[model samples]
Target: MIMKYAILSQTKDLMPTLGLGTWQAPPDVIENVVYNALELGYRHIDTAFNYNNEQAIGNAIKKWLNDGKGTRKDIFITTKLPHVGNRASDVKKFLELQLKMLQLDYVDLYLIHVSFGFHCDPEKFTPLVKPTGEYELDMETDHIATWKKMEECQKEGLIHNLGLSNFNEIQIAKIIKEATIKPQVLQVELHAYFQQLKLRKFCEENDIIVTAYAPLGSPGAKDHFVNKYNYSPDTFPDLLGHPEVKAIADHHGKTTAQILLHFLVKQKITVIPKSTSENRLKENMDIYDFELTPEEMNSMKKLDKGEKGRIFNFLFWKGVENHPEYPFKLSDDKD
Candidate 1:
C-alpha cells in the first residue's frame, strides 16, 4: 500500500511518502526496475535529467499504461532541471527536452537539481570546467531569475508543482521571500547518520515537505564512490549494523533496513530508497505495516551526527565549495 502525505500545494495533491529513486540505477536495468516497481504498487517514481535514464523509464511507463495497470493521473512522476541547464534562459528548453525523453507532456513535480549553476556546452549539456579543476559557474545566473522561469513553467502547465533539491536554508529563505509560488518539497541527503534536524525543522515550519534521499545512509555508497575516485574519507558507519538499530529490529521482528525506513516515515519525512532486489523492494514498501515506539524513535534520533555524517558531499564537482550557494559549507570533511 502507498502512503500519501498532504503537502502544501496549489491544489489538493496527495503525494506518496514512498518513492523509487532512479539515481545511479543503470540504464540497462532501470526499465525493468521501474516496471517491477509499478507492478508492486508504487505510485511515485523519481528521476532526473542528470540520471540519464528517463527514456527507459518513459518506455516502461508507456507499456504499463498500455497494459491498463494504471493511468498517468494515478502516478506522481518527478524530474529535475539539471545543473547543466541551470540558467534562467535554459529552463524551458531543458524541461521540454526532458518531457520528450519521458514521453510526457507534463510532470507531476519539477525541481532544480542543485543550487549552483554549471556552465556547460550548450549542445551536450556538459559542464565546462577550468584546467585548474574548478567548475565554471554562471556567476550572472541567480536563483530568483531561474525561479521566475520555473514559475512560468508552472503557469504554462509544464509542471504541476515546483520544488528544490540540495538547497540550504539561506537559499530557500531567499526563494520564499521572492517567490510567486512557494516550494512544495525539498529533496536532500538525509539519513540516520546525517539527520538534518535543523534543516528539517526549518522546512516543516515553512510547509515544505522533506523527501529524504539515501534514507538508509546508502550503506557502502561512500566506499564505492571514494574507492572509484581514490579519494580519502572512510566509509560511513553502517546504520543497518548499528547495535541499537539491530536490537530494535530484532525486538520488532523486522529487518534493519525496515527500521531505518520506518524511523523516517514516522517523522513525517518522505523517502525514496533504491534497491534492485525484488525482496528488498517489497520490504521497503511494507513499512506501513508496522510502527516504531517513541523510545525507539528517540534512540534512532540520537544517531544524528549533525554535519559530520553527510555522505553525498558532491566532491566530484571540483571547487563546489567555492559556490555562493554551496549547501554543505559547514564541513570540509568529505564522506
Candidate 2:
C-alpha cells in the first residue's frame, strides 16, 4: 500500500516524494527503520551497494512480505551499480549479488552510482585522488560500454527503471544522445544552499526526473560516508531554521524536514532522507496530505546561494577524469 509517491518520469510510478537515505545508518537499525517506515506508511526505500546496507534492507523487506504486512511489490526499492561493477560480465555478476542480498529478483529502479568506470579489475580496484591519479586500466570498458550493459540489464528485466547519479549535464548529454533508453531519473546533490536550478531545468526539459540529497544541507556529521569534508553550514544560516523556511513550516505546522521535502515534491522531484530514529521516520512520512503554495515555494527558492555546490566529492574514486561526467566547474562553465 503506497500512501504517497512522486511520479518522476512519464513511466515510473508512485515513488514517495520522500524516502529514506541509507548512507551510514547501522545495519541493525536499518532493519528496524525499514519495518518502522513501512508501519508508518513510508512506501519507498533508497539504498546503494556503496552504502553497504542493501542486504539489511533486503532482509527487512523479506520479513515484511513473509509476515503478510505487505508484499514485495508493495515497496519501492531503488539501488545502484558500483563503479567497479560496471563491466558487462561484472554487472551481470553484481546484479546477481544485489538480487540475492535483497532476496528479490528486480528493483523499482537501478542507478549507475557514478558516470565513469574503474581504472582496474576488482582484485586491483583502486581509487583516484587527483590529476596524477590513474585512469581506466581496462580501456575496453568505459562508461558508455558499462551503460550499454546496464541497458541490457533493463531489457532482461533485472531492473525496471534506470537512473544516473553524480553525473553532470555534459555527461548526461552524452548519454542522452547515445542511449537508446534515456534516463528516467537523475539523482544529484541538491539543497537549499545549492538549488541546482539550471541542472534541474535541463533535466526537466529533457523529460528526466531529478532526485535531491542533503535538502537541509550537510549536518556536519563526521562519518565514513558524509565526512567533515563539506563546507561548514555554521557560516550559513541553517536552512531548516531560516525565517523563510520556519514561516513555511509554521504555515502547515510541519517540521522543517516536511517543508524541505514538500518544496521538492512541488517540483515533482524525489527526495530520500535517511533517519534511524523511529519518531523522525514517522515524521518524515507524514508529508503526503499537504502541498506547498506557490508563494512559499518561491520564497524557499531565494535561499539558493549557489556557492560550494556538490557534497558527493568522490575525489577518492579512480578514473574520474576526461570521461566528461566529472561534475566540477568546467573550463567553459561559469566559475
Measured by lDDT, the strongest candidate is 1
Stretches of model 1 off by over 4 angstroms after superposition:
1-3, 332-335
lDDT of 1 by residue, 1-335 (tens): 32456555655687899999888887789999899999999888999999899999999998899999999999999999998888799999999999998999899889999998779887778889899978897666589999999999999999999999999899999999999888999999998988988899999988899999999888647676776866665556678788999999999999999899888878889999988778888999888887788898899989888788887778778887777777777554433
- lDDT for position 140 in model 1: 67
Query: TM-score for model 1?
Result: 0.95
lDDT of each: 0.87, 0.74
lDDT digits (tens) for residues 149-220 of candidate 2: 888988998887888888878888888888887888898888776788888889989988788877656452
The lDDT, on a scale of 0 to 1, for candidate 2 is 0.74
Per TM-score, the best of the predicted structures is 1
Model 1 clashing residue pairs (backbone): none
